[model samples]
Target: QLDDDLVSALKGALSGSLEALILGLMKSTAQYDASELKASMKGLGTDEETLIEIVCSRNNEELAEIKRVYRDMFKKDLEKDVAGDTSGNFAKLLLALVQTRRDEPSNVVDYEKIDEDARALYEAGVKRKGTDVVTWIEIMSQRSVPHLQKVFERYKSYSPYDMKESIRKEVKGDLEKSFLTLVECFENRQLYFASRLNEAMKSKGAKEKVVTRIIVSRCEVDLIKIRTEFKKHFKRSLYQTITEHTKGDYQKALLSLCGGDD
Candidate 1:
């Protein structure tokens, strides 16, 4: 039930990626793990399992270790291998991820880059959610939180607006806030989400979509922190919030997202 729009967007990214790229990868990679390949054949193999696992699992501290070993084992840069095996939108998105590396802290940020990012995000998420999510996920999951914060702060400054208010002012529809919250939470787990949720519960009706967005997108990555955010910000337990606003599959999913910690 993804609908025609979502299907079309995903297909567009697949087509642009070049069949040769996918076909070449589908042949020898045998599950995207480049680690098993000999140094001479590294570029010829896909190694996606190792790559994506590291991308999805490693925080900044661990990612450097993975990067070091990947380069040492392959005898070539990890970036180069990725470039060789992927193309088009998929390549563009994945390269953005591999290049940025992590969300580590930075001394300064460029505001203009944020505008470009906003443009890219608008094009990807609002205009086309399917393929765009792939791209965004690669970048967001790959980059570290500190790096993402710079982009988030810069984005806020460039637009000169808070995401919640901005959404209220500029965008309409239930999903916009959800998407914005995803960007916010991904950017600064400690600051963005808990603050907003607390503010929402106190000042306005708590929006279920905001809670849903964070739970669905980030629960696996940082549920304990999220529960803390809910407690600290709203001054109400997260479980209480869950009971008030949700039930059934969504609630089950959220509880599951806490990953059995609760």
Candidate 2:
């Protein structure tokens, strides 16, 4: 076990991106997520991207734990914080996610319901003059991932645009981004993380916080898959990308956490 005093000492000794990475790595996953949520909502403005990514991507059990940890650590309700920080349809979608109401992944896929949902999504967005944000939120939030996958697949037949394109046409701003993130996560979560990592590294200087959060958060879960997807999609390994984008202890730490090349 990592000693709390020792961790505090290390935190005191270290600074900058390296310290952030190291400290983030040391927290329990739920604790890390809770802290990230708090940080996103801190101070002048909310980091809505972080809020969307964390809230929309996590499964029910994980979100439940994160919400609990958020209250315990910050003495603030995660739902209230989210609701307070956001408004309109975006807030509604995020609050729904925070409720942790998503159905679990299961082998059993209901094709009948899946088709119905696909049609519903089509009518709500592509088929209608105005977007039905309520239907979009309900289906996206409450349905199982497997069910959603099939629904998105079936949705292609009903509408000229796929689910993502439909979202783009239907909404704008944070809501659009959040829905897109949710769909991407449902489609291929590892690929979603890989894309996030790539986006972080695409510019001249790395977005170190985003890089650290995804690498550290998903390290134990699905990083190997993320590495493979990164290589396949971006034509460069995550290991190499990190090497090119970062240096010193921060680089070394990320490389080690990356495990190895694809």
Error of 2 at 134 (Å): 0.7
Candidate 1: tens digits of C-alpha lDDT, residues 158-208: 454544454444443323333354455565554564564445444454554
- How far residue 247's Cα lies from its native spot in candidate 1, in Å, is 30
Per-prediction RMSD in angstroms?
15.2, 1.6
Q: State which candidate has the highest TM-score.
A: 2
TM-score of each: 0.34, 0.95
Those runs of model 2 whose alpha carbons end farther than 4 Å from true positions after fitting are: 1-4
lDDT of 2 by residue, 128-178 (tens): 999999999999999998899899999999999999999999899999999
